[model samples]
Target: MELSVTAVILTLTAILCLYYWNNRGRRSRLPPGPPALPLIGNSLHIDKRAPDRSLIQLGRKYGPVFTIWLGPRPAVVLCGYKAVKEALVDQADDFGARGTIPSISKVTNGYGIASSNGPRSRQLRSFAITALGHRGNGTSTLEGFVQQEAETLVEAFTKTQELPFDPTFRLTCATANIMCAVVFGCRFDHTDPKLLALLHMMDENMKVISSPWGQLYDLLPNLLDCLPGPHNRLFENANKIKSFLREMIQLHKDTHREGTPRDFIESFLAKMDEEKGNPRSEFNDENLLLSTFNIFLAGTDTTGSTMRWGLLIFLKYPEVQEKIQSEIDREIGMDRTPCMGDREKMPYTNAAIHEIQRYANIIPLNLPHTVTRDTEFRGFLIPKGMLVIPLLSSVLYDPSCWETPKSFNINHFLDERGQLKHKDAFLPFSIGNRMCIGEKVAEMQLFIFLTTLLQKFTFRSPVEPSAIDISPLSSGFSTLHHPYQLYCIPRRPARRPASE
Candidate 1:
């Protein structure tokens, strides 16, 4: 009897899935795409390991705006700068809501800023901007945090005796340490076991999420959740990381002051206390825990990964490294630390960082967005709550917008005059309302971190430069670098400041 019941349930599931798939694109006036199959929609069309590559291929055939199915759901994918800018920037109000990530949405449960929509997102966003420190108003508390971490990072590399070692671990620690100081008001010692374990979890989480397992889980979450797989490791690590955040939140609860907030956690806790009487406030324990987790996942990984990609590129082309290091030496000299102010004076270094961000596909398909209400975009009807993907790689690598979209060229971010020239399509942190909240902090961190290291050391790969493979090992949710070691030989520039 049990077997019969299970068979009956399975039959019903298949029938419903088939019914939904049969009418996939016909029901909605979403932009046209290739035909979808029964029960699977267009899952087979996507390369599970690297969905962005497949998506880019499809975009060429289907045009900038088109509909594709990820399992039973019909999503509108916006490709290229013009189409993406039209929806995300031109109609920011309709496309500002956050969409779901089924693979881990169960874990987050729509409580945090990254996963939440509407009122909660706005409230959290407003609070975050203020807490991250005032960027241009000269009250940049965040810059001090990043600069301190950058100095420590340089010292750590200097201790390696200029031997060849994988800089991934040290770089991760350096970037994560900045987040720790911003969030918790303290930085961890470079050799701390606690910090090491957290970084390991982060690294593992990235691997799983970028693998086929994570993509499959997102595509067919219902079926995959019942079965055991490598994607399970991602969930496990994410949860453990959340648990760590929870403990930290509890610790802050014991010592947090009301008006004198030291860090983001304290400021948030004080706000929660202020809003305790308000029934509709989004500032609660769960939001705090998940929001901080969102920061850890985002703030730590992107900066660290970009830096790693940078080293790989430099190893591949030592000449590029020479140009940036020369710029650093001439502009800042060896006596003073590099700051956000110096970024303007050193155009080549600034352009180098911009090109690295553009060339390294850090975030491929950016965070999913949703339609706030029934809307029309590029001659198609998009119903409220429909998932919309802004393909970031499409924009960053769009041929129309970039001179050498397929190549690693610093000239893309520079003009013939050798000054840093900003490109309209270069939206690495993304553009419009739902853009990354930590943009200012990240720019400061990357500039200071890169320049500070160059101030004290010159990087060289163990093998000859030409033998190094600059290609990424994997590209799914984001690009991942393979294991490579390098020498951070100490250096001091004797040249005088160029414009001083």
Candidate 2:
């Protein structure tokens, strides 16, 4: 019995020594990072509760590119424009794949473009771009869609009798309609239960994904899945969205055509049929369903949040708002509704819109991309499957890139002659091949809705400047603040016809 006990103790001692030796020297090879504790690593130092600020603090100490331990996983953070550009742009395809967090995998199921890599990712991305007609210079296909949605939005808002109103629910509805129009080839009224559930799911999923608890759950999903938490709630929400997408797919499948496609749903369904027999086809019902729902979540919130931010800024900076209003009046005139084409004529207004995107910086750290192959960036070794985050907020707010990154300066986008100048650093939509797929659609909506709203209503603060706290609260992966309401007061044009 003593012999057996001695053997067991020896084996335990040997295993512990091996584990210690394994982790001891591994830290030096990786990039500079914070001190870590046992089992948790640097997670103890990190405010996993507020990863963004925690990361920003770490970036200051460790330079732009640094490593942090997400439990046992090694996560490399790319901060500032230089580091982000190096990894995402200079070494584009090297970091084409997305790193799948345990929580994200549980939520997304490794199905959508946000989670996958390789040929499947490429195929889905290529197909989405083609289907949306987001190609080349001056594409009219997406512009037309934006214009239609803006008109419908105006009609809906007009129903409210020029009274003091909160634009949140309506604005979300209008923005969501455009998303729906793109994905399912339709729009939903704000009161629709199914649509409400989808939006809530999108919001909740984002919240859970960015939380500390969420991070822990992601790191240990196998064990966590058996227990109950916010992650589980997010998963349930994701499933509901999937179910909604399935219903929409069935509807599209029931009524689809070959050459004459009705909308995105019809077009995608047609593709599935055409590629049905192919062994390598990725156009199955499941992919189509997930991709469609992905659009609904991605397209709607980003644009809607942006518009909400734009109005808040307008209320804060009335002079700038007035300048935009004046430009809109001169370019599009008081009688007619503003369209996508009007964007060029109204240069100042366009610049202001662009500035709003830069100032808001909704996506502080963009969707994480995985290093697909071994690559070197700025003399640092980036191994395959490493999570590379491109901090877009760094680019938008880069001191070298912008003259005044902090100030809400429209002039940054305006040249000496006050015409719109597209700055290379102004990449709210992000850069390279794996950029936001619905970028064109988002731009179109921004131009149309921003211009249209300025023409119709002047956003004003309900109380004094001191009463307003413009600081943002955490929304999700995105940097949206508290739910502040705005008053949309109708503006009477300089020239009203006798009919009015």
Candidate 3:
């Protein structure tokens, strides 16, 4: 019995020594960070609900570049303007690869533009950017599509009859319709059941992705997969979106002709046919469906959420809204719709839009990036597969970068003459090779949609503007503004006839 006890003690000692040696080696190689416990790592230090905020706090303690052990895997977080810019922009190629988030990868099956890496990522992303850039025909530019959707949105708001309503649903539909037109070569009515269902799924997925539970899933996917929770529902919703896109693909296939591609879907189909015989080609129905899913998911939520936040911010600061309206009225007038060209001339309006994006700070902790090869960054060795988070919030809210980092200051984007001045650190769409694909489309949507709304209406909340909580409702991977109602009072046009 004593011999057996001695043997057990020896084995336990050996395991402990191995564990310590492993952790010690990792610690020496990685950048400085807070101490992490075994198994859970630094999970306890992170506020699951607001990982971005937690990370910012960590940045304060550990400097710009530091490693945070996310469940035994060290993630080297690049914080503030300088570190992020250096890593993402200066060393772009080294930090260009997309890191796998188990949660996102499972849903995407490592196939889509958002989650892909190396050759596949390059091929799909290049094609996607080109497809997104082209005017559908000679006449149907993306700007035109956005303007048309802005009209539909105006009609929907008009039906609200100046009453207070949660504009989230309407705004989501308007944004999703624009994406639908781009992807499927069609638009859905605001009341379309299928569109509403699709939006519901997308919104739910966003909520899950931006919730504390979602972060937990990303950190502990295998463990959480075994447990019953909302994470399971995220997969269900992903499948639903895929199934819906597949149906749309089938419809496109049936109606497809040889000569002209109507939208992104048809364009992809033509590419697929061209590459049908190429064994290494990434063009396939699976990619088409997943890429379409990426476009639809990204195109809808981001712009919609930003616009929603823009309205909320307007309610929060009426003066800013009025200033933008004045600028729009002066530059574009009310009779005609605002175009992308008007943005250059309307400085304050442009400034306010930039301020909105900066203040909102959506996607605070950017999608994770990975090193393509073993890299020495800032005196620390980050292995090839090590996850790197470019803390976008740090840059947007960096004191060194912005004069008033914490406040809603439109002056951040304005020059002494009140002209819109570009700030290098205003990285709402992030930077480098993996910058947002839908940047142009999003810009157009925000400008045209917000300008259209402001041209016809003065937005106000029933309560005092100062009382409105502009802080995000819940933050995880993304920041979501708290749901609020607003009154849209129609404004009389200054230059044109009322009927016109």
lDDT of each: 0.86, 0.75, 0.88
> In model 3, what is the error at residue 475, expressed in angstroms?
2.0
**Best candidate, lDDT-wise?**
3
Runs in model 1 deviating more than 4 A are 1-14, 21-28, 135-139, 495-500
Residue lDDT tens for model 3, 1-500: 99999998899778867978866765578888999876578999998878888999999999999989788567899999999999998999999999888888998898978989988999999998888877422235667877888988898888889899999999999899889988988888888889989999998989988887888888888899899988888999989889889999999999999987888999999999999899999998778888999999988998899999999999999998889888888888888988888888988988999999998988899989999988888988887788999999999999998999989999999999989899999999999999988887788888889999999899989899879999877668788888899988989955556794
Given candidate 3, what's the lDDT at residue 258?
Answer: 93
Leading candidate by TM-score: 3
Candidate 3: residue 367 Cα off by (Å): 0.2
The worst-scoring run of ten residues by lDDT in candidate 2 lies at: 134-143
lDDT of 1 by residue, 1-500 (tens): 99999999999888887876876555568788878875577988888766888898999999999889887778999999999999999999999998899965877899887888878988998898888756422346667778788888888898899888989999999999889977887888978988988999988888888898888888889999899988888888888888888889989998776577877889889899889999989999989998888877799999999998888888888898788888887788887888888888988888999999998879989999999998988778898888999999999999999988988999998888999998999999888988998887788888899888877887899999888877667788888877899999888656567895
- How many residue pairs in model 3 have overlapping backbones? 0
Cα-based TM-score, every candidate: 0.93, 0.90, 0.94
**Window of ten residues with lowest summed lDDT in model 1:** 133-142
Q: Judged by lDDT relative to the true structure, which candidate is superior, 2 or 3?
A: 3
lDDT of 3: 0.88
Clashes of 1: 0
